[model samples]
Target chain A: MSKIIVQGVAQGTVLKTTSPINFLGAVDKKTGVIHDKKYDIFEKSVKDTVLVFPHGIGSSVGAYTIYSLKSNQSAPVAMICQKADLTVASGCALANIPMIVVSNEEFNSIQDGNQITIDTKSEKIFN
Target chain B: MELTSEENAALNGEHGDTLQTAYRILVATGEATNAEKLIPIKWAHLSGVNYNTIGDAGEQFLRELSKDARVKVKATVNPMGIDFDHISEFNHIDDEFIKKQASIRDSYIRMGVEPTFSCTPYDIFDLPEKNTQVSFAESNAAIFANSLGGLKTNKESAFSALASAITGKSPYSDLRKDDITTPMTIRMKMDNPNELDFGMLGFFAGKVGDTSVNISGVSQPNRRSCKALCGGMGTSGTCAKFQFIDSEDEKSEKVDFGKEEMNEVFDELNTAEKGDIITLGSPQLGLEELSDLSKMLKGKSFEKRCLIFCSRAVQEQARTLDYINEIERAGGEILSDCCTCLTPLIDTNETDAVTTNSIKGAYYLNNSTGVNVNLKPLTKIIEDETK
Candidate 1:
């Protein structure tokens, strides 16, 4: 298992999406399902998993969507992105869902359903 | 991130939970962007008000935050989901959606935000000093403040802007740095440029994907044309700012666009065969635009639905000048606060197609609503719809 230091801490099974997620149009706030039909992860629930993606795109309201997910008790346990735009950063912070950015190489090395743990205090991710 | 004593205290929850949360988000954002410190800001403009966009989750967040959080600086809010004054007029919309929209406005007001409810806050508010640091969330307003107003702001998200409003600070990075603000050169030479031509130029620049662009060769542009240009650019791309120069400036690489290129852009953006509904004011119309629109509709009455959206401030001014009455008499409905892009007040299913002069409006309506949008000059929309 490879380990790397990062910004926020969490442990969960990974659910990866190759394409970027736009939470505003791409998410169903009530159910936490990925509603964007264009992506392979469409109809997947983000709840209780390590949601991994390249980054977020589209409306800034995405921050609120993430907050809505958390409020509805349907938020992912953790998130790992190749980069963190303000939308993801702010959203994750507000939702209190741990998030970290990983290098593309490290991100590509992992597969869906792989159990992972992130420790922001220790600044490390253990697989 | 290096934190000042006050910042450290805020992060440590010495100030309050609201400030602590704001500080934590700001610090996290700063870490992501590699910002060294947080800087004080003069103003903060927030977006994410439309219930159709933010939904229930956003409303809960605002409600909770507003209970204990008061803005530290001058802050203005973006448009609500519906026109509050004429709520009864829009009987086509759902009562639940209207209530959500009203709650958004009420929550922001309780948080001490000015009820501007306008995207083009620069139009009504006094201009900030040159190079003044501010925080603005709306893409078009942020671009305009940076490019035209000569103020400094990054394209902020709703949460980040609200954080800045509460804390009176923002992560110092990107547009705040003077060295990175220098733009690359993209020269444009157009013959007899109009508002539509300017919008096309902005669309082309957005397609280029350059953050900072210095454009030359455009003749003196009026405020409305400039607004259209910046609005289109911000909508289509992530450009922070653009500078316009005279035709004689010979120091940079230039791209020249003519009538052919303009027509190509129009073809790409126009998806409607004929417009069933005509909508305007994506960034919310300025007083000048309303005046011109009123004049254009003087002798015309449309059988199809026509909606003109503006801010409460501008709407009041238009009323004082009798422009609202003339537009209404000509069979046009004037809506305030929200526009076609942000709200579902205008049902795409009810109308076969939509038309607008606003490039931003056309793009968002087409993408978000799955509606066919027709891109035309305002004159053409008026002429075709009236006939």
Candidate 2:
């Protein structure tokens, strides 16, 4: 798959969600499972996986939720979004989670449960 | 991003670990936004105070940050999860939740934050001089500082605002200059405009997305009207600052709105039925609003639960002015430093409906709490409650 450099790079199995997540309410802090009822990924565990989504929505406090995930040792190993806003950027920075944005075509090429390595240092994603 | 020698030293860890991390985050954010350099700021207002919203992870992060670093500039904080004085009143909030919330407050206090615990810092704090650069995180407050106060501040994230508070600097970028202030024009034509009309106008504007908008036709809005407008706009859209043109002036494409549009917005936001809880002060009530509410509540009693949330400073003033007595006498509760949307103080399951004067509160409470909310004017809510 074609690679892009948006933030940092890491590799994990993909956990995809179609809806934009508001991390503050969407994810359970202690369990790391998607709890927001609005999304199809409800009850899916994001722990240590490369969480993929379209983008982040809702409160800016979602940034802190991401940090809390790391503090609880329940954070996704990495993140990939179609677009990255301030909330996502701040969360990744604070949590030290590697994240990158990809084009729609590249994002479409990847599926849930796929093994992938996103490398920002080399500016590539290996599928 | 270009950094000065001092900035470089901080980034290089010569200054200290806290400064290094702060500067690094700022630099990264600046680079991401194509900011050429960082500018010094005199003030910073931070959000993300509620323990229910931030949870344990947020508490730990704040504790760690405060251990090594303190804010360099004068800073104020947003609301906590519960009112410290009225803790026993909110039985729905457990002791564990209270303890975690208190820790977050303590960390900010230890960091030398002003502990204002308010979203509407402009009402209590000294208004920044026009063009004064500041870093603010609360969307309503940030937009107010930018649009109404004539101050310059981009809508900051909680993390970025904390970073700016530590270093007293923010990346010099969007909404900081006058040259880039022009936005898509939204012309409002209202007949006999009142407080509710202003609120609906904001609700409509916010739905317009990230497009910078200039609102024309309304002139010289009072503090509460301005608050309602900004709060509604911030809730629905991402526009940070909106220009106000009192008189007709051709600058950009304009969308004219009238009373019909206002009713539509009111209809859309007011989803709950009568006899629901009446909530005020989503952005936290200002002094004038409290005074107005007190006047409306004189010789009147509420049939349903009415909660008025404001800052400690404002509450103190209201108490001194005997407004608190009037509100309490009328069977309304005054909650300070917390509101329904930020905290789990109110049990949503027990609450069948909610009537609020704040569009922001209605929107958030509906989504986060899963309670039916009716957005209405303060006058209407008071009248309904009294009747």
Candidate 3:
């Protein structure tokens, strides 16, 4: 299979999902705690890493979370989105978290454990 | 632009005493967001910032600029006070938090702000009709103004929106509908989830869409539920932030809902199966809600195997009220903003299925974490559990 990658470059700590908590309120910049109390899934701190979500969901403050993460030096190096959003764009621009977007179909080909890379110059993503 | 020379002068800080600070704050905010000129808004809704946050440079700026003007008072709806409840069985009570909202509200009042103290302004506030310029803080409310009532506004911070409200004009940038409403693709089933689920789904969709939406696959919503979806949509995607709902059948009681809100919840209910974990409080919890939860668990203990949810902010507050400790004492875990961004909660070899009321929680867990999700209504869950 031609694993066509949507490559882009970003600076962030590569984070993997271990539990299910909404990404929106998942990470808090002020405290650097990932609050997802109900499920024993995952609750770890994320800072200065590449945080990629197969997709986006959460409060608009999710953008502010990125800003708070960055301003407090608690944010990822960059973010990769299956789709781009107003909050993410504004936050990325405001927080300077380099971002790369890929298509859903393209993302499906990339596995969880696979090491994927993005290059901002060409706005391309690859594994 | 409606400012007379005197109003402009006041905006420029010609006003005396308190009005001076308000004026300068507005000017700086307008510049930051790229407002060409200031316009006088008919109303303003603020988030009633914390006393500590008000001490920042933004606060000083507001004080210096809002001199002589009276601020032409209006109503406001800020976030709930830090601690307003004295007693709750779901958790303990914190008497100390009582003054938190007071301090924040007092400072805003001193600087000329009204504190309606709610997340949903369309519920109570006298919002101007389509194209009527308005200014409001609270992320959820900002999208509500644009997507629900057709009024115009941009997302202003604690101070910026207040400034715009006082000035009666927003930056005039993306607040316009033509600039905000864009189309996007979203694949999610929403069925009769409760109001909380409605809001969560909107958040997830926003995250997935990553901008404002012109989407397919959902339908019909109650007005309030639509606002919840709009609020969530504003979080990740659109400048305006919205979703259109689809419905096959609804009673007269259901007509108030928007197509987007109904479609999502109905889809979830129809599809969700048993044995899923339900989580709540993704955007954080309210002080009053904390009190309610304390009562919910006064005598009963959580089914150790079930899943629950809450925000990091609420966790901190709970600690103060002993709610967190109590929840722990009762048999549940309280975590800070933990998940997706951190180490790995999903990809790890963990549980089988997760259930939640927060639409954002369900969407992210299923999409990002690869977890099976069960979403339900908060009210129904409470009724079932309590009964």
The candidate maximizing DockQ is: 1
lDDT tens digits by residue: candidate 3, B1-387:
233576577756566544444455554344333445666577776643432222222233334344433346464644432323312422322343334435444555565655444455565545676787777665667777776777766655554555455555455545543555344544445446446656756655654443354444455665535654664555444345554544322221222234575565446433356433444444334444555566666665655333233434445556798766655554544433222211132332454555555554454455435566665655555555432
Across residues B86-118, which tens digit of lDDT does each residue of candidate 1 receive?
777667788888787888888999999999988
Instruction: In angstroms, give how far residue B112 of model 1 lies from its true place.
Output: 1.1
The best-first sequence of candidates by TM-score reads 2, 1, 3
DockQ of 2: 0.35
Off by over 4 Å in 1: A1-7, A11-22, A31-54, A73-76, A104-117, A125-127, B181-210, B245-269
Q: How well is each residue in A44-94 modelled by candidate 2, as lDDT tens digits?
A: 889989998976654567778787888888999888887655566667777
Number of the top candidate by TM-score? 2
Encode model 2's per-residue lDDT on B17-113: one tens digit a residue. 8888787667655754457899999998998899987888788878888898888999999888788888787677788888999999999999999
Off by more than 4 A, model 2: A1-7, A12-22, A25-58, A73-76, A80-84, A101-116, B189-197, B246-271
The candidate that wins on lDDT is: 1
lDDT order, best first, reads 1, 2, 3
TM-score of chain B of 1: 0.93
Of the two candidates 1 and 2, the one with more favorable DockQ, higher being better, is 1
TM-scores of all candidate predictions against the true structure: 0.88, 0.88, 0.51
* iRMSD in angstroms, per model: 2.9, 2.7, 9.6
Give the lowest summed-lDDT range of ten residues in model 1 chain B.
B247-256
